[model samples]
Target: MPLHDFRSDTVTLPSPAMMAAIAAARLGDAARGDDPTVADLERCAREITGKDDALFVPSGTMANLAALLAHDCRGGEVIVEEAAHLYNSEGGGLSVVAGAVARPVKGRHGILAPASIEAAIRGSANPAVAPTRLVCLENTHNAAGGTVMPVETMAAIHDVARRAGIPVHLDGARLFNAAAHLEVPIGALCRPVDSLWFALCKGLGGPVGAILAGDAAFMRKARRAVRMLGGGMRQAGLIAAPALVALDDPYPAHRRDHALARRLACGLAAIDARLVDADRVQTNIVNCHVDDADDIARDLGARDVLTLSRGKNRIRFVTHSQVDEASVDAAVDALADILATRPNWSTPCRESLPT
Candidate 1:
């Protein structure tokens, strides 16, 4: 049987419409700001995010790095969640590439509280320590089972950052997912931050690209930083074209993904109540507890169902735009079958049990 790939949204390929958009793209050098399709996409992004400007980068990672480089100019420190993609998933780009230190603070789930920000700031200060110049946040935080950070929490952190005279950058790779889940406008989820990055390649389902949106001056500097990092592409309209479609297509892809997640989560809970917490199944990500996650993955791989271990014993199933209801049901049935017959799958999951 074919694999029901729920490993990550990045595994999704562009739809047929997206492929058509890519083929029909009007191209020009993006470095010289002449790429018509790219320029159109940027304009749409700026309008959508209610920002003065937006720069299209190759990936969400680049967009986050660009925002950080533009905002944290003074050899400073960045405050981030202990489990943030920027802190845990970005390969230490803040320290290695931006030459800044990440001051990570433990937070509830993946959402950072205002007090944590204030405390982290206070702890990082002194003449001997790097100045805390930026606060980074993630919405639909990946490491925390795609948890959505509430708008109030974001406003509180923004208030704290404002009082400290620091800029806030939101790593909103899944910002649209959060907006869809909260039934709010995407702008409402983004307006409080000094800068924000959103992905075209995630649930939006574009082939490759992300947008970094902010004020005019911020984007001007960020464009330079993107170039310095060798992310400046020529005729990038090829990718931007599909990204534009992904942004404009009036599809409830995220809601569909979330619905499938609910289905999968519910089905998993039915089989093993102690395994996956259906209540924690938010957005499109589900973290299921099982003993020996790698062993489970290997066993599932034999039947061609891809999964990722969140830890030693926690396997993550991420629904995406490409995963339909049939696929979700098939994956769930496969897991149930695995549990019914396999020795390892039948073993009790003490370490992997969801809290």
Candidate 2:
């Protein structure tokens, strides 16, 4: 029996073509600037993001952390959305590892308020306050059911940050998703920030890696920070080759996933389960509320369905390139069955942070 894996896109395996690319990759000493494949990937990413340079990192977390470290050089603070990956996920690496503070502002879903951003920046003005040096925004924000923050909002934040002389960094892990969902070019989605990073592993279908693109000078600094974090790779072309393949063959998993999410949302809504706003299903993620996620996840897992129980009862169902239309619909039907038969199911509850 096959397990319907709605756990996350990270579970996606590389395609046969990607494997061939990886196997045929030519290797060189990356530390000494001899890896031609990694070099090409970096160059390609720069061109894709319309940036002066790009640095290939082992993971999105490293790329984001390095970008932040480069942005807030003088032990400065970073303004970000309250539920951003940098704040909620990443294990507090920004504060503990990089010696930078994250000043989280209230935002709807993963969307940050420009007014809230302005207030946060102004609020950090006391003598003891850490200098606000950077603003980070996530598009197709993962925590917000993969919501797409519009380009105008991005422009407004960019304008505010520019006037304050603060650099803005975008944690564009699922940027391609944002671009596809908005029907905009990836470069247009990236025009608002000083630095941006995108992931190759998730949805892009690469086996491993992420890329951080920025101006030439900032990239030079980011390289040093990369070394500081021991991310300086050797023979990284092995990973870069596959990333090149994934990027070249763009797919509509973003839209398909969004549709799957809507199906899941409507299915659960029919059963009256505590759920996220169906209208906000913009990309691939579907965050739903269940009062007993542990038991529910276990129940589904026993039936060969996997999901991420974010909290005690909050679950995140993610559709990927691997989950075909049939699987998506089956998972929705499975959930409906769960809610229908389970004695504790069928009630909406208050939204609370996953415990």
Candidate 3:
């Protein structure tokens, strides 16, 4: 049997159609703005995001870094949720590359409260403190088991930022998942923020690239930032071609991935309800709590099942285009068997479960 890889959506390989599009791509020097395929991809991205302009970059990290650099000057502060990927997963690029400071605020399941956001904003006449430059939000927040932030919640945060004269940037790496879950157009979600980015390589199933979208002037600033960061490319349509196809209509794939994730979460709950809160499995990522995450991951790997250890006692499983319902079922069965055979395995008390 083939390995059941549930580590992340980034592991998904491009489909054959995507490969064909890549091969037939029309390429030119992207640095000079002549790559037709790249232009087409950016146009599609802009249309989908309801932004005035969009720029394709090498990775989600770079897209976010460009947005940060464009929105804030050196020594400026960026507000983010404590569990956001920007604060925890992006390798400090916001500070190291963009020369910005991160001010983290605790959020509930990755959604920042409007009051907390307002409180974190700094507007005093003191020069000692860094002025708040931007507010960053993650939709379908990765660290919080892919929880989707409601439109109302995002609007509230945006309103607070607007009143404080702070720009809002959305790290929407999995924005499609959030849109699918909410049954809303991606543009509806994008409207609240000043700028946002989404990954084509994640649930969209493109082999490479991400898009940063906003107004024309902001994108021009982001383009310069991309070049400054050594993110420019020549004949980049090889990657952009596939990304165009992925962006054309991603809802079907996103819907399937979300369904598979829920199925997997439900199955895991049946085996041991303490393992995961099925109600919290809102998108494509399922985070399960175990007594020993590393031990469980290693054991699952031995069975040709792969999952990522999030911490001391949490494992993450991400469903994508490459994983089907059958594969999800197989993974759930393997995990159920493993837990059943462990002599010391016991359901934890509800009060003791991690939130």
Q: What is the C-alpha lDDT profile of model 3 across 1-355, one tens digit per residue?
A: 8888999999999899999999999999998999999999988888888899988899989988899989964688899988889878989998898899999998888888999999999974789999999999999899888999999999999999999988899999999999999999999999999999998899999999899999988888998999998899899999999988887778988999999999999999998887889999989999988888899999999988899997777889999988888889888889988997896776544433334
Residues 1-355 of candidate 2: C-alpha lDDT, one tens digit per residue:
6778989999998889989998999889887789999999988888888999898899999998898778764577888888889888999898888788888887887788777777777435587878888899998788777888999999999888887888889999899888888888789977888999999988787889899999988999999999999998999999999999988846565667667777777766666635556666788888877778877787778777899887775788887878876676677677767766776554445557421
RMSD of 1: 2.1
- The global C-alpha lDDT for each of the candidates, from Candidate 1 onward, is 0.85, 0.82, 0.90
- lDDT tens digits by residue: candidate 1, 1-355: 6678989998998889989999999999998999999999999998889999998899888988888888864478899988888988889898888888889887776878899899888434477888888999999888878889999999999999999888899999999889989888888988889999899988898889899999888888899999998888999999999999988842488898899999999988998886677898789999887867887777777777888877777888999976778888887887888878864454445543423
Candidate ranking (TM-score, best to worst): 3, 1, 2
Candidate 2, residue 353: lDDT = 46
Give the count of colliding residue pairs in each prediction. 0, 1, 0
Off by over 4 Å in 3: 346-354
- lDDT value, candidate 2, whole model: 0.82
> lDDT value for candidate 1?
0.85
Clash pairs (backbone) in predicted model 2: 293-313
Clashing pairs in 1: none
By TM-score, the best candidate is: 3
Winning model by lDDT: 3
